[model samples]
Every structure is written in C-alpha cells, then in structure tokens.
Target chain A: MKAKIYITLKAGVLDPQGKAVEHSLHNLGFEGVTGVRQGKYMEIELATEDKTKAEADLDEMCKKLLANIVIENYRIELE
Target chain B: MKAKIYITLKAGVLDPQGKAVEHSLHNLGFEGVTGVRQGKYMEIELATEDKTKAEADLDEMCKKLLANIVIENYRIELE
Candidate 1:
C-alpha cells in the first residue's frame, strides 16, 4: 500500500518563499495573479496488515516529525 | 481565475529532507514505510483573459522562478 501526506502551513503564517514566488509571477506579466501559498507533498509506500495500525502510525508520525505542530498540519491518504 | 503550481524533484535526485522525514517516521513505529518523495505545491489566484496567455505566462514563470529547470519540473492547474 501507499500513503500520501500533504503538509501545509497554518493560516496567518508568514510564508516568505510563497510571497517571493507570487512577486516573480507578477513580474513575468502574469496579470492579476495574487495570493500564493506553498505546501509540501510526501508520498510514502508501506506494507500494512490493517488500516487501524496504519492510521495510528500515521498520526504519530505527523505529530512527531512529519509536520510542525506550531505552524503546519498534515493529512494522510492511503492508496 | 486561479492557478496552482506543483513542483517536484526529478527522479534520481537525492532528497535529504525526504529521507530524514522517512527515517523519523520509522523511528515513530510506522513499520514498512519506504520510498518517500517530497514535493511542493503552490496555489495561485489569478484573473486571466485567455488560457493561451495564462499558459505562456505560467511556462515562463516555471522556467525562471517557479521551478528549477535543472532538477525540478512543475505543473500548473487553473481554477
């Protein structure tokens, strides 16, 4: 099985990288472009016996390291 | 109109950050997790007159700033 983790910064967080990208786009003549937010996507392949264990493991991973609880949140999808 | 940009490292590119996250997940007892790849997603809101120009502008942005042409590729989605 495969799992995908989407990690994103929380609202009101200052994202300098995203702001820079937005500015560059506007400079490239991309008219009316506004509000750029950046996030991370991680795909993990795993072999699991059951969904319950997988969910618990994923939750633990997210809380410990997959995401920064102070500024980011993560979601996991099984495939 | 809105455009989303997804940027990912090309295959064979070594990603230390992704590897670190994977190792940490294993330590957190996420068994059988393997092969992790990390990427970036940027959501951009835009008002565009036509798809042609939007695509051109997006292409330019990707080549110049939105992505690193040497090691990363980018895709755009209009919303």
Candidate 2:
C-alpha cells in the first residue's frame, strides 16, 4: 500500500518562498497569478497491507515527525 | 480560480531528505514504512477565470520556474 501525504502551512504563516515564486512568475510575464502558498508532498510506501495499522501509524508519523503541528497540518490519502 | 501544483523528483534522483525522514520513522518504531519520497505542493490563486489561459500560463510556469526540468516534473490541478 501507498500513502500520499500533503503538508500545508497554516493560515497567516507568512510564506516568503511562495511570495518569491509569485514575484518571479509575474516577472516572467505570468501576470495573472497571485496568492501563492507552498507546502510539502510526500509518498510513503508501506510493507504491510493492514489498513488499520497503517492509519494509526500514519497519524503518529505526522504528529511526531511529518508535520510541525504548530504551523502546519497534514492530510493523508491511502492507495 | 485556484490552481494546485505538485513538484516531484524524477526517479533516479537522490532524496536525502526523504531518506533522513525514513530513518527517523524507523527509529521511532514505524517499522512497516518504506520507500519515502518527498516533493513540493503549491497553491496559486489566479485573478482570471479563463481556463484556457490558466492552463497555458501554468505550463509556462512549470517549465520556466516551478520545476527543474532536468530532475523534477510538475503537475497542476485547477479549481
């Protein structure tokens, strides 16, 4: 099984990288773009097929190491 | 309108960050997890509502800035 994790910055977290990218895009002639926010995408493959254990493990992984919890939130999609 | 972009490393590229995360997970007792890959996720808000223009612009953005054509590939989802 595989799990896709998306980690996004919380609202009002001041995304400097996103701002820089947006500026670059506009300078590159992509004038219609705005409000850019950047985050993390992770793909994790599991050796076990137990859905219950996977969910429990994923939650623990996110809280412990995958996310900041203070300024970021993570969502997991199982495949 | 909004667009979500995902930037991922192509196969055969080194992922030191992902490897470190995997090691940490294993040390933390998440033994069933393996093959971790990390990437970037971005959300861009567009001022225009034209879907065709958005697609065209996004392609340019990915090629010119969002992705390193040599080692990464980007996918965009519009909403």
Candidate 3:
C-alpha cells in the first residue's frame, strides 16, 4: 500500500515562504500569478496492503510529526 | 483561478531529506511505513482563468524555478 500525504498551513496562518515565492514569480514575469501557498507532500510505501491500517498509521504520523497540528492541516490518500 | 504544483524527485535520484524523514517516522513509531519520498506542493492563484495560458506559464515556471528538471519532475493542476 502507498500513502500520499499533503501538509499545508491553516488558512489564518502566515506563510512567509509562500509570500516569497509569490513575489519571486511575479518578478520572474509571471504576471498572472496573484498568490501562492507552499506545502509538503510525502509519498510513503508500506509492505502491507491493509488500507485501514495504513490510513490510521498515516493519520497518527501526521498528528505526531508530519504536521504541526496547531497551525497546519493534513490530507491523506491511499493506494 | 488556481494552479497546484507537485514537485518530486525523479526515480533513481537520491533524496537525503526523504531518507531522514523515513528514519524519523520509524523512530516515531510509524511501524507500517517502509519507504518514504518527500516533495513540494504549491498552490498558485492567478488573476486570469485562461487554462491554456496558465498551463504554459506554470510549465515555464516549473522549468525555470519550481523544479530542478535535471533531477525532479513537476505536475500541474489548474482550476
């Protein structure tokens, strides 16, 4: 089984890195760009095919370390 | 309009960061996790809704900045 996790900042949180990227894109001649938000994506492979177990484990990982739950949100996809 | 970008290391490329994360996950008790690959995810908002133009611009941005084409591949999604 494989798990894909997306960790992104909460809506109200300030993202300095995203702001910097937006500014760089604009300066790079990407005039149409108005905003940018940056996040982390992880692809994990497990030896087991248990989707239920994988999802639970991934959720735990997210809450424990992958994401700062106080300021970030995480989404998981399984395959 | 919004565009989502996923930048990942190409197959066979060494990812020190991913390895470290994998080790940390194991130490953190994510036992089911066997392998991990990490990447960047970005969301961009544009003033224009023209799909064709947005795709072109994003592709250019990926080539020029968002991704290191020599070692990474990027996928773009627009909405």
Candidate 4:
C-alpha cells in the first residue's frame, strides 16, 4: 500500500517562505495571483494489507512529528 | 480560482531528507513502512476566471523556480 500525506500551515499562520515565493511569482509576471500557501507532501510505501492499522499509525505519526499541531494541519490519502 | 501544485523529486533521485524521515518513522514504530518520498505542496489563490492562463503561468513558475526540472516533477490541480 501507498499513502500520501499533505501537511500545511494553518490559516492565520505566518508563512514567510510561502509569501516570498508568492512575491517572486508576482514579479515573474503571474498576473492575478492573490495569495499562496506552501506545505509539505510525503509519500510512504508500506507492505501491510491492514489499512485501518496503517491509517491509525500514520495519523499518530502526523500528530507526533510529521505536522506541528499548533500551526499546521495534515491530510492523508491511502492507496 | 485556486491552483494546487504538488512537486516532488523524480523517481531514481536521491532524497536525503526523505530517507531521514523514513528512518525516523521506522524508529517511531510505524511498521511496514518500507520507503518514503518527500515533496512540496503549494496552493495559489488567483482572482481571475481564466483557468487555462493560470495553469500555464503556474506551469512556468514550477519549471523556472518552484521546482527543479532536473530532479523534480510537478502536478497542478485547478479549482
């Protein structure tokens, strides 16, 4: 099985790197771009057939280390 | 309009950061996790109704600065 996780800064959080990229994009003539938010994507390959246990473990991983609960949110897609 | 871009190191590329994270996950007791690939996710909010143009511009951004074409691949989702 494969799982893809997306971790991103929460709303109202200050994303300096995202802002910088947005600014650069605008400067590069990308018109109409109003805002940008940057985040992380992690793809994990597992050999298990138990998706329930896998998801549970992955959720725990996200909360414990993959995502900063205080300022970031995460979503997982399993395949 | 909103566009979400997912960028990642291409297959066969050496991803040191991803390997480190995978090792940490294994240490943290995520069983069955065999490999991990890390990437970037960027969300852009645009004020225009032109999806085609936005996608084109975003593709350019990804190729030029948002992603390293030599080692990375990017996908765009428009909404």
Highest DockQ model number: 2
Tens digit of per-residue lDDT, candidate 4, span B20-59: 9988988888867899999999999988888788878888
Selected candidate, larger lDDT, 1 vs 2: 2
| Model 1 regions lying over 4 Å from their true place | none
Query: Could you give candidate 3's per-residue lDDT for residues B1-79 as a string of tens digits?
Result: 9989999999999999999989998898776678899999999999987889889999999998889999999999987
Candidate 2 iRMSD, 1 decimal: 0.7
- Per-residue C-alpha lDDT of model 1 across residues A7-76, encoded as one tens digit per residue: 8899999999888877877777765676788888877777785788777777787788778989997888
TM-score of chain A of each: 0.92, 0.96, 0.95, 0.95
| Candidate 3, true inter-chain contacts retained | 0.91
Question: How many residue pairs clash (N, CA or C atoms closer than 3 angstroms) in each of the candidate models, in the order given?
Answer: 0, 0, 0, 0
- What TM value does model 4 have? 0.97
DockQ category of candidate 3: high
lDDT (0 to 1) per candidate: 0.79, 0.93, 0.91, 0.91
Judged by TM-score relative to the true structure, which candidate is superior, 1 or 2?
2
Question: DockQ for each candidate?
Answer: 0.72, 0.92, 0.89, 0.88
Pick by DockQ: 2 or 4, better one: 2
Whole-model alpha-carbon lDDT for candidate 1: 0.79
Clash pairs, model 1 backbone: none
Per-residue alpha-carbon lDDT of candidate 2 for residues A1-79, written as tens digits (9 for 90 to 100): 9999999999989889999999998999888886899999999999989999898899999999999999998999999
Considering DockQ, which of the candidate structures 2 and 3 is the better prediction for this target?
A: 2
